[model samples]
Target: MKGVLRFGKVVKLSPRYIGPFEIVERIGKVAYILALPATYIVHNVFHVSSLRKFISKDPSKIITEDVNLQSDLTYVEELDRILEFSVKQLKSRDIPFVKVL
Candidate 1:
């Protein structure tokens, strides 16, 4: 079955399982961009960076943060900005060719 992948439709994916975990689908431009928050939970808490490698054969395609330093905070702060940016882009809903990268 087909599904709606947008900020508004995120609710639908919140309570369901996708792959090894439950996730809400989010369509960015061309392909379905996995929800970052959900992805973070699985990535950080569960320790599965394999998804990054799976998404992009070239390491450059995979987005990352610089937490290698001596900072002890939490999740990558950049993800917050990314989600905010993603929401804005989706809301305008005008440019279909805009790339988040």
Candidate 2:
């Protein structure tokens, strides 16, 4: 995963899976080394429980954008579009909120 090792953050907003990297070699029964990109500073070896199989419906649908990371291992997230917008009314105020993609 992208920020799997990052601590003191909200779990729900964290990265689920970063890549579908190729397996380089198997270390033991449950450990395997992956061929990750050079930009990633994490350890190549990982436990089998942390990995997930990638299922692709269409190859052309996959987005291959290059994410530029900062020195702190964070990237700027840009807003694509607003999916929804709504206003909540209270006794004395109205709160506006947006659901974005």
Candidate 3:
């Protein structure tokens, strides 16, 4: 996929699918052009693997959430916890490595 990586900071906390973005058109076989907001400077074309279809079980329903999208279209993420720690072997000695959630 030629598309760039987004939500680097909030990769863990952010929801995987943020939209039912309108599909402008289909590009080739597995690619699509979406009508994303102007804040998203990245290319609109995305591969099929990166896209998810939105389905509504009820005809009349509204979903709401407290999502904050920054000027760059990136959302905020919260830290979960520190899972574990390990020792890293160096040339001179070993050092402590911390893993966070």
- Leading candidate by TM-score: 2
Candidate 1, residue 39: how far the Cα is off, in Å: 14
10 residues in a row with least lDDT, candidate 1? 68-77
For model 1, residues 1-101, the per-residue Cα lDDT tens digits are 25642222345434222223223453443333344443232322222322332444675555543222212212222322222222235554754332332
Q: For this target, which candidate reaches the highest lDDT against the unseen true structure?
A: 2
Residue clash pairs of candidate 3: none
Give each model a TM-score.
Answer: 0.17, 0.70, 0.52
User: Which scores higher on TM-score, 1 or 2?
Assistant: 2
- Whole-model Cα lDDT of every candidate shown, in order: 0.33, 0.74, 0.72
Q: Please estimate how well model 2 matches the true structure, expressed as its whole-model Cα lDDT.
A: 0.74
Error of 3 at 8 (Å): 3.3
Q: What lDDT does model 1 reach?
A: 0.33
lDDT of 3 by residue, 10-101 (tens): 45564557667779999899999988776655578888997887788984564634456676667666669979989999999999988888
In model 1, what are the clashing residue pairs, if there are any?
none
User: Taking the tens digit of each residue's C-alpha lDDT, what string does model 2 give over 1-101?
Assistant: 55456422337785646666779999989999988777766678989998898778996677645556566666668999999999999999999999999
* Per-residue error (Å), model 2, residue 74: 2.6
